[model samples]
Target: MKVREKKRPFQVFFHDNAVDSYLVTKRATKKVVASIRAAYYDNSSKELDARYRGELLVYQTVKVRQRQAEHAEKFYSVDDDHCDLQVDHGEATKRWCYYFENISVEELSHPMNGTRLR
Candidate 1:
């Protein structure tokens, strides 16, 4: 026998729209570079989480700027009932660790022309 389950997340939904996201800092870029340099680094879990959050910020911004007020997605405050113990550990790496770690600033900031880190 099997069962289906639904779960809530532990992420904060509130975000500032100001253009000062830290995913592309010079420091962050350096970290990304270093991670790539360290071949076979088994940190795909962390990297994937960063990448996922980065994409979310970009896509959310794109939606805010392009969509009308009523249609725009609203950022809501977190509620106690909605909170969960387990959080997203981020995506599982689909390729080698190096492939997952080769993220760059340009790609994070501009998804349309994201840098190919392969």
Candidate 2:
């Protein structure tokens, strides 16, 4: 059988809440923060670190929290799945439940070429 994909069908929000050196390392321009060690709560399965794997939980947005976080980023692929997911199950309304890899500020600045998820 074909192996199941581990990544979520939706995109994720990257909030840097002074949680660790994540802000500092993520801010280093022209460099790659290779290992983004994070704990994604409210989720289960091979979805994450084995410590919190396979929990398979999801929730809705009751509210939004704004912070004056000096270093924060909404890590998203411009070539994203905004138009693919069910309208009622909007990815924009979720929180703290996914991962982003091999991203950089420079890449975010330019427009991507191909259509997404084709």
Q: Quick one: best lDDT, which candidate?
A: 1
Score residue 72 of candidate 2 by CA lDDT: 38
For model 2, the local distance difference test gives 0.31
Instruction: List lDDT for all candidates, in order.
Output: 0.42, 0.31
Q: Per-residue error at 115 for model 1, in Å? A: 73
Encode model 1's per-residue lDDT on 44-90: one tens digit a residue. 44444586775776677778777766544443322223353222222
Q: Which residue ranges in model 1 land beyond 4 Å of their true spot?
A: 1-49, 68-118
RMSD to the hidden true structure, all candidates: 29.2, 24.9
lDDT of 2 by residue, 25-62 (tens): 43442132222222223233245435433332212111
Q: What residue runs in model 2 are displaced by over 4 Å at the alpha carbon?
A: 1-29, 34-45, 48-53, 59-118
TM-score, cand. 1 vs. native:
0.17
Clash number for each model? 0, 6
